[model samples]
Target: MKRFQRIAGYLVAAALVGYFLWFASSNLDIRVLHELLTPPVIGTLIVAALAYAAIIPVTGWAWARLLAAQGESWPVSWLTAVLAVTQLAKYLPGNIAQHAGRAGLAMREGMAGKSVAITVLQETVLAVAASLIVGVSMLAASEPGLAQLPDGVRPVLAWVVPILLLSVLFLSTVHLSPARLATSPTRAMRLLGKAGGLPGARIALPALAAYAFNYLLIGSGLWLLARSAELPAALDLPLITAAFALSWLLGFLAPGAPAGLGVREGILIVLLAGVGSDGELLAFVLLARATTMLGDVINFLLGSLWLSLTRRIAR
Candidate 1:
């Protein structure tokens, strides 16, 4: 039964790829890919890959600091690996694998206290807050299909849940106080006190900047890829930014969509249909996905190799 389920998942993922490919055919040029992968061009690809790899550590450090803001410290290298692998594990069945990866890291490294859980929750809160704040700000500026709508247009009103959720999160964290926890979770409150001069909002502020910068880098890549593929210059920056942002956010939350392959392209397609020509939009999305995946592959290799070498040197 397990084997059968695994096979079914592969089929479903493959079907999604086939569907994506049909639309992305124009941008999946064999020659362009070869050019991009060549020895001469590989250097530029390496830089992109390294930038992507660096993002994991930077975000991990910011989050690790959030933990320290509660006067706790954990192994960041281990946490970074767990985060990276959790991202890769999202493609597995049910997304249980991904969550397991995160929870397992917490338990294995002696971070099984209530304080760790509190810190983890705080990190999740800050991340979502940052994502949606940028998202909402950009979504309002979306062009709303000027000249013509792309396809599968959902109502803007549907986004209220995520926006509201984000708003509530920001309010809660911004005014968070150790005194508010007097009646509950005393252990966690004590840890917060040990943070000394570091305030909770001080920790929260940096997560916002990190997430926004991460999105900005990825969005710029997508935008440039679109132009390279000859998409419209007059295209709305806000629309692209919002669409790309949602794609990343949803891809993270989505089950069994490792590296967010299916959800990423699928969401991009739907977003494009709302605002750009189907053919052109699909072309650029394909380019964006390829660039992103290629970078991921390189990052995984470099990180894996670096970890292996460091262990050997220590030995």
Candidate 2:
């Protein structure tokens, strides 16, 4: 069953990759692609890519600090490498692979697998909490017309209300607890561990800052890209970038869909739709995907080759 699932997952992942490749190729608006590839765009894309990579350190720091709470210290270099490499896994299919790879590396580094997994879980929970907080602010700042959304949407919002309340209440409770909780595998019990007298409130400020900076870096890069492409108005690009960030986050969370294969494209198309002609939007999306994927493919090849050589040398 596991083998079959893995095979099927690979098939789906492959199909998505192939689909994007062909879609980009066949629909290549040569003129638009050329314009999008200009110097300023090249620079913005480079900067955007760096920003995307930059967030890894903040995450590594978060993971390291959290693990320190459990009396474990691992090299930031090791953690940083694992974070960067495993990120490639996100573009494929399952997020579990990234977690699994990180866990294996952590285990190999002398930390318990469960402990490392717990740290990963803690980072995810806090990151998610941070995103939710942003979502609330976005909701508040937006026009209330969306509030008059369909009745069906109202129920979802209603559900969200209680969930948010519960989350905040739970966080308050955790905030009041003492620092230094046990490292356990149980999710329910672990919440208490996270909830304890830890400095989560203070930690949240930085985490929020990191998350915002992480996305803003990407957004600003895209803004530069848009400026190069001569796309109109910067007002909503940040929102589009927010949508892109949300999609990227979803890609990160997706099970086995490395970097969210169909996921990134899906998110990007939606975001780009309102701003440009279909021809222009499609061209931009294709170029953006190509730029990032090329770097990833190069890194993957380099890592694979290095691993193979190192093994041969030991023999």
Number of the predicted model whose lDDT against the real structure is largest: 1
Off by over 4 Å in 1: 1-51, 75-78, 102-107, 113-117, 142-199, 234-237, 252-256
lDDT assessment of candidate 2? 0.58
lDDT for every model?
0.60, 0.58
TM-score of each: 0.67, 0.67
Give the Cα-based TM-score of candidate 1 against the true structure. 0.67
For residues 47-158, could you state the per-residue lDDT of candidate 2 as single tens digits?
A: 6555555667667666676666556787664566567666576554445676777677668757877567666766776776555544443333333313424557655655
Error of 1 at 274 (Å): 5.3
Instruction: Give the CA lDDT, 0 to 100, for residue 170 in model 2.
Output: 57
